[model samples]
Target chain A: MVKPMTKTKFLERLGAELGIPPATLREEAPLNSFKAWDSMGHMSVLAMIDAELGCEVPPGALQKCKTVGDLVALVGSKLES
Target chain B: MITQIASHLPRTVLANEGLAQLYPDWTAEKIFEKTGIRERHVVDEGECASDLAFAAAERLFAGRAREADYLLFCTQTPDYLLPTTACVLQHRLGLPTTCAALDFNLGCSGYIYGLSLANSLLQSGAANRVVLLTADTYSRLIHPQDKSTRTIFGDAGTATLLSKESGSRLHSFVLGSDGSGAEQLMVKTNGARFPRADGLPTTTDESGNVHDPACLYMNGPEIFNFTLKAVPKLVREVLEKAKLSLDQIDLVVFHQANAFMLEHLRRKLGIAPEKFVLHLEHCGNTVSSTIPLALEGVITTGRLKPGMKVLLAGFGVGYSWGGCILEW
Candidate 1:
């Protein structure tokens, strides 16, 4: 069985995928503030979400996210459980 | 069996440093870490996919081009929308007039599909030897400043010669596609469905990558998700069809899409690092040429040898995917 992915784990994984230092990222951080959140980084985030949580975030849905918190919400909504 | 495999890259080279100069935020090391692409070759002004294909085929043939009884050219970027590129290649290569030749539009999954066709033609006694050429100059289809694509794709063509043999065989293949996800990675214009319009419209996405209606557009996350779902299943189905397990496959080579994705799949599928092959560091994603190029690399390095069971999987573009086991 897979570990239940918590919001904290989700953000940490997302930050790791984007190459963000662990303690440097705040939950309310704007998604656009990070230089690594470019197109490739965007793809990495979604892949990370799917790999870490097994939830495929629709590309359009990702486009709607403004803050890292919004991304967490989008991912949480798509969780299989 | 694939008797020989040859690959060709265009003259112009685009290194990550070149890309970093354009997109300052990305350093060469940073780009390499993410994509595992150091440099990619692109075609020059007068060059095209066919030219590269011709060159690679010439090298593959080495004056034996006339022995081919059939020719198959796999590409998405054909020279002309009218006469098929394979026909022109046949004549240019001096293949016999009786040879059956045609072009099939496929991307990363092309080499597998080409091998499948060659297998059919040989098994049916339709042809004695098949010239399978997979080439694509995706650089022609990409927007100039689209860092996402420019950093990932490079142009290349590869020629693989296949012939029926008693000892070695091209085993069964598991091929797949999903058109519903076609828009995820595609070029929207320059086709019968949507002819080119003047003043190509462009849009800038949140990632700052430009989307030109006339150039390539890849929804990276969507394709990644598709791969995450499709590839493992494809691997399982192919293994079942062959009645073999992962340990039995001597080597595994998948399309060199990107380093991150390939590394992820390698781990997710429980594929051992030493058994897997990655040739993307220099060539980047050469579309259809990737698998063959990787094969050629391993062959030269002695990683692939006669009697070894090699598993090849190609997935992407057309949302197409395929897997097959070959006795090398």
Candidate 2:
């Protein structure tokens, strides 16, 4: 039985992966608006998702990512694969 | 009233091989004269932080003096991101897993923080024996060609066995941090995905790119300003915390960054030049291991008689400084 990944778990994982305090991240949060989502932060997201999702997020996929909603969509498609 | 300390240092020495090649005109002797450094030990290539850490740990536990129940490892270069070096060390040392093991990712003020943590743990009856290790392979992070940092840092590690004050132990410590000026001294890459994020070649200074390793950067004047302002105050505070006056202390083991800074600090603190244990002439700044290594090298020949008061202080990198007094 496979458990479905939800926005709540994904965001929680994202927060932990980036070493950010949970409350600092929001569903409506624009990633670039915060200093925490810089190059390192983005890489941490990519690594964390790869480890948990069992696949690479694809080149340039991260640069395309701007908001939490964008990240969710990207992650959701990877889940389908 | 700083706590007692026991320490172990690496047996090998690694001279700054990169400096000579980068600055062809400068000689090692000249570098030594300027920085108060002769040579520093670097772990062989492919060696991880734990390997160097284990060497020190083995010496610390070799005598089996007293049962150590707590393990605290202070290092900036850890072996793994997931399992803290404390746990791995605990497993390797065969200490009971139930005992608390923690990793403090601190560099210069590591020993002070380690002592403070041990004191708190002991005062609370959490544990009587604690093992604190400080190790840094700055050479691993340093750009081979960046003369600014290359000449100043060296690779080395130290392990201290802290126990309850049976006949002798630690006294007290004073510590401080300023986050605003953290960037003044740091390894600006290879952390939290900065350079490692994409595997695309990251932009680097001409000298730094030659080796492809993350280079330690410093704003020399800013760090100097930070140290000049903080070190003396912190020393006074630690002495006060220990309830001792400057005259009552015997020896001072400061972070051996360089001769100029140490001399300036000695002058500022009004401590007689003889009160300082001089090891920088032989071993460059060993980062976190400086104070402990100095203690080991000095105790053998420097006449650190029992029950004499000594002060240990460390400053740099983190824009952090810490000091403590211990009765040998």
Best by TM-score: 1
| lDDT (CA) per prediction | 0.86, 0.71
lDDT of 1 by residue, B35-105 (tens): 99999999999898999999999999885645888899999999899799899998998888898889999
DockQ of 2: 0.01
Candidate 2 wrongly placed segments (more than 4 Å)? A1-81, B1-12, B16-18, B193-213
* A7-43 per-residue lDDT for model 1 (tens digits): 7677678878887876777778998988777767777
Q: Identify the candidate with maximal lDDT.
A: 1
lDDT per residue as tens, model 2, B1-328:
2233444445566564546666785677766765777676666777766676777777766767535688888888898777888898888877886768888888878877887888778878888777777887877777665565667777776777766665545767778888877776776567775755355444543223233425566654455546666787888788878888889988998888777567656865678988877777656777788888788776667568788888988888777888887787
* Candidate 1: stretches off by over 4 Å: A19-30, A56-60, A77-81, B63-65, B198-200
Per-candidate TM vs. native? 0.93, 0.73
